[model samples]
Target: MTEQLPLERLAYWLEKRPDAVWLTQPVNGRWHDFTWRQVDEQARRMASALQALGCQPGERVALLAKNCAEWFIADLAIMLAGLVSVPLYPLQSAESIAYVLRHSQCKAIFLGKLDQPEAFAAGIPPEVIRIALPYPTLAAQHDWASLLAAHAPLQVGHRQTPDELLSILYTSGTTGQPKGVMLSPRAFAFAASRSVVEMQISERDQYFSYLPLSHAAERFLVQMSSLYSAGRVAFVESLETFASDLKHVRPTVFFSVPRLWTRFQQGVLEQLPQARLQRLLRIPLLGRLVAKQVRKGLGLDRARILISGAAAIPRGLLDWYQGIGLTLCEGYGMTENFAYGTFNRPGQVCFGSVGRPMPENQVRIATSGEILFRSPCLMLGYYLEPEKTSQTLVDGWLHTGDKGEIDAAGYLRITGRVKDIFKTSKGKYVAPAPIEGEIAKNLWVEQVCLMGSNLDQPLALIELSPVAREQAPARVADDLEQTRQQLNAQLQPHERISHFVLVREAWTVDNGCMTPTMKIRRNVLEARFVDELAKLDAAQPLHWQ
Candidate 1:
């Protein structure tokens, strides 16, 4: 058996299944496949190019690209050359990109397809070499093809230790400025091995890579796991074609965020009228047959495991998926720990909990209910932020900033962020995440943000589903009112949403209302909708005093 680390695993794949297809991409509407041998060769060439550019060991090389085969090639090259890889989300603004590049002191950057290169050009220093990816342009300052052609084949060695830094992932910075979470090679390997064990990922499994590689959860689970298990990974061409690409790949193992899963549910529910669906599901034999067909049509027929992480998944969505014979297991982790802190096993899964901690890690709920973790997978510390690092990691335990309770069965149910729990002026403490999760269960409501910081009562900002608007524009208001009434009946007077503002536009990363992981940025959302929320406060309620 091969050693359980990145470079060792890569060598194992190179020797064992050199001709096995490792990665596939759609370019100009055609599929391009790469074997393990081809991947290793390309990575070696890129490693040589990095060395030729005077990239010393431990230096950070940044890759700002959408999910592509070359992204993995570049990542492997960085590891092979004994350097650290820093992946950035392709959708991030030029300013955020510049901040990460400068903060990490990245020597070389691989810029992917961008809408505005001039914006990036203006922000980055002239000395920093910006290499455009496979599809080169005359406008690009440094051509990646020419650089690779001039470089010799890199010499591979076993110089990297488990403790050596492998990656520095920047958090989404929902609360404040993003911190660089430094993860070692061993940490990445441990997380990957544990995930494979828990989720039962194998070499025969196929994964559809769509999530942002910058995010640790996706990187460790999908990207690193590919290397460990020698699994094949397919990249979607664009966000617009994700559904089509998913059908094409028919991935055996998949992972997605909660928002996408909710959208999937909305899509299904929208196709059938609620009255018709309720009646149809009441039939025993026909309902089972219809559901089986629905699951197959949705390209989930082959999926053995579907994982959701990076945020809390609403229990309602979980049950809805379960009804359709799909198991959407939720996991929990952060950049500081390289993902896979806890995950629901294949057979032993729960609805709202993020399962138990992986075998390699130890987790404990603090006296105040904060989640604290200790593991070899834990990062060394934040890069260049010693003070913040000291505060976050004390006595070898990572203060996750999340409040949760561990059940008798060891499943971890995350309630809310410690800082996000707000107190109403009426002296009631409210955890908005659970409340928002409950409100989002309504199929018509796509996204909900609950806010009541020092206010008399809680209020919610809701984004309606596309189907809700197209099918019943006039009914949108009525449906929202009904939803509010239903939710209010379930909550105490202070915890109920006294009022809500209907936002037609979706909250997305581009709009700065959500993080890259699709978690709501409470500060930004509150600021943007302050006026609308204030207007709601002044309005009269139908039932409330």
Candidate 2:
């Protein structure tokens, strides 16, 4: 049963629990529920409409939307229509949107909630059919209501073979051009079902969907996992209502990135200062009560498992969550492997490690210190780029560009990216991630990027957290310098940071300094700060932009 494809699993749920509420969505502060039967009918209707639009079985269908109930329905409809899915990040630049639409040669697109629809609408080719979801969106030839009313529910849906193409998820474009990663039904089925078993997921679990569904991590973790486990999924209405919606859902299985987790922590500290909270937490009886109250307030009181991924989380942040009775299991994976690699199991978590490989996953270190993985869930190849595909997938092993070290206990610790490692003027190699992690332990810092390819010493570009921005400038600077000195004491002479350059603006997806997944774009930052870096003196400990 676990080996069945997601659509087959959806069918199983439709038969067993037709009336069960599988999706809950908040719109205009009102709750809208969709049962398994309704989900099936809607998906079928959309599938019929898509087929009616002259979409070939193997033709590409792009999904451009924020995380919503309709996003899931559209993706499933594409699968049911036998069309390959190509998801675009809703927050991506218009140029990126145009590039993906043109590169993938999508015949149609399903548009949903977007921040800048007008700015991006021109990216869609005129020939492509536009189907808009039930949201205030750009002008489209077909709308959700019209499509459902016009087409009957598809009686005979396309049954995907094990190795048939499922999706082409583009990379986050941290380095340069986002390569389209080709995935199949076999890849998702093996990874999601096995992950369900490993994580002990069940129908009773609840998932809060906020992350972009385009990313392989969120798609596999939230979307596919919910399909396999038959879990109820909920979507946030908007950023303004995120807090209220989160409280309303109270999801049992929550997956979040480091930046959001840090934001949550900062929100708590704003209401109740850390010093006061820490003092209360020291008391035996009062501590548990306070912790429980804090969890309840954060809407994580019902969470059975909390996962942190996408990037390395600061250890101090994890410890702070632990103090509040929330244990975050840090996992490691890549889009190429369907986000299945290593994950810290419940009750057996090792600090600073991503845990052991999955039961069926083969992991080894290359002589070049790169992490290599061969798993059933590995991607087929990159779309239309045979040379890049060959370079990535060699001899059945997925060459994960991450440098990692495995402990004697089998815990995998990601050291740095093989490409991200840089050399100083003296030709000494430096891995920035570990040093960035150390600098991130300070609550004042939000995002940090270390780059000094040809400089005498490496310097860090720091983005101050909201809390730090609100604090006294003198205090924040003094505290940051203290942290920098302590961090340098633990590092080798050449690896030590010469100066901490503070950026005035936050590195957001909109600003193009961060990816949609909240990872700092190193290349973008390096190029953006070339002029500033040249002016920085070695004697200066802190340079504010």
Candidate 3:
């Protein structure tokens, strides 16, 4: 029978698989495991601690951390106490954190290993209780260990219904200020179960938790999926050590965003020279042997499913992975729908399409061609933003601000974000994402941002791979000219890039060009390069060299 929600599902698992491993964390070069029984016990203790601190039912408790065992403990405790969990991305700035804290009115917060706790301390008011996760060099404040040791596990009698608010996930704020997306326990449970069904996840599956749990896609897909299926979640120590950690875990199911996938693909390609690699891959026998070695080296030999979402996966990258014997499935969804709406099924995977809509979800294109969806997993509304909520959810359908077309076989191909489409001086509308996706498929190109807001045609700012920069310096101008010609040949005249600028530096989250999930903030990049693009457009053959 289907469980009502994650908390209920966890309770069921506690009864059936009390001794089974629920969470695994790597500490001091050792793997530590937590059983279902331990999870339940610790969560109860945390819930009691919150109760002891005067946290009432339905009150908000924020979690500010990376992927860790304590993160789940805090989340389950909040739910067990019938309180709402508010997740904050660990990399969020001080201002962003302060805004979320004040907006959500979170009474208590569990802080994780932060690079700058002083920033956090300054942002949050002193009256709000702060519980720091077990980390080194913590300031003299509310310690998590002391709270857990002092308080006894309260009896979990305050039960929450299926429709009760479980979580408040703030958007990444790529487009605007972050707004809290409130989700019911029922909505999260449905999304998790649907993901399990569509992805064919099982209790035996092992997931590597690396993505920020604050993001809806990772929170529901990894955290909630583990609770629903009684699977094991392995939390990596740090982002720098993810590859080494993956080698140790050998997870069966792995989910990553497009940027990580691109890096992984590049790593594989870097192992071999172009001519020799092409030749070896052509021979059937040697190609199979090389493929096995590559997969093993990447620690993906045991990977049953490699899923990419949260941003668009370049079709060429998808095809390249497929050619290398890895079935990388791309999915499409938004925070409003609990992070899943359409996914590519395992055996029926398509390259460019986001595949068929999952069970219990209806997807249709509006007259204006925006993709509209109706799903059981749909979120209730934005927290305290009734006008915006009404604008998004109307007539029982969620207006996904994505422009797309459904194929005859029911595969949804996302063309671009509705707001991202720009009209040129000739009044021809251009969807830059698709063209950028195509350009990014080239091994040399690391990142591409297309722009032409009020111009006659599109212009592109590109970041090149290190190898590409090193090897082609002498022939840089010739190579770029050839690449531009090839790209323009594949595009309509108006949509073609009239000028190209080679951005020498890499776009990164720390640099503010990319989001934490590695999505390029188009508005920021456009604003930064406005002058350079204008200069390029006026110049003859734009030469960064």
lDDT of 2 by residue, 1-545 (tens): 44998789889999999999989988899989999999999999999999999999999999999999999999999999999999999988888988998999999999999886898877888998999999998899999999999999999999989988899999988878899999999889998899989999999999999999998889989999999898999999999999988988999999999999999999999999999999999999999999999999999999988999999999999999999999999999999999999999879899899888986999999999999999889998999999999999999999999999999999999999999999999999999999999999999999899998999899999999999999999999999999999999999999999999999988998988988777889989988999889987767779999
Query: What RMSD value applies to candidate 2?
Result: 1.0
Look at candidate 2 and tell me the lDDT of residue 221. 92
Which has the higher lDDT value, candidate number 2 or candidate number 3?
2
Tens digit of per-residue lDDT, candidate 1, span 206-232 = 999988888998888889988888789
Pairs of residues clashing in candidate 2? none
Candidate-wise lDDT, in order:
0.82, 0.92, 0.83
TM-score: the better of candidates 1 and 2: 2
Q: Give the TM-score of candidate 3.
A: 0.96
lDDT of 3 by residue, 1-545 (tens): 36567777887898998999989988777889999988888888888888888899889999887789989988999998889989988778777888888899999999887666676666676666788888742363677788788877767535767777888999888767788998988888888887787677889999999889999889888999888877799999876687899988888988999888878877777787656766877899999898777788888989888889988877778877776688987888888888778888878888888988988889999998899999777788999899999999999899988989999999999988889999888899899878888777776777888888998888888888766776756575567667788989988988888877788778887678887667889999888888777666355554461
Which candidate gets the maximum lDDT versus the true structure?
Answer: 2
Model 1's TM-score against the true structure? 0.94
Q: In model 1, which regions exceed 4 Å deviation?
A: 1-3, 115-119, 136-138, 270-278, 537-539, 542-545
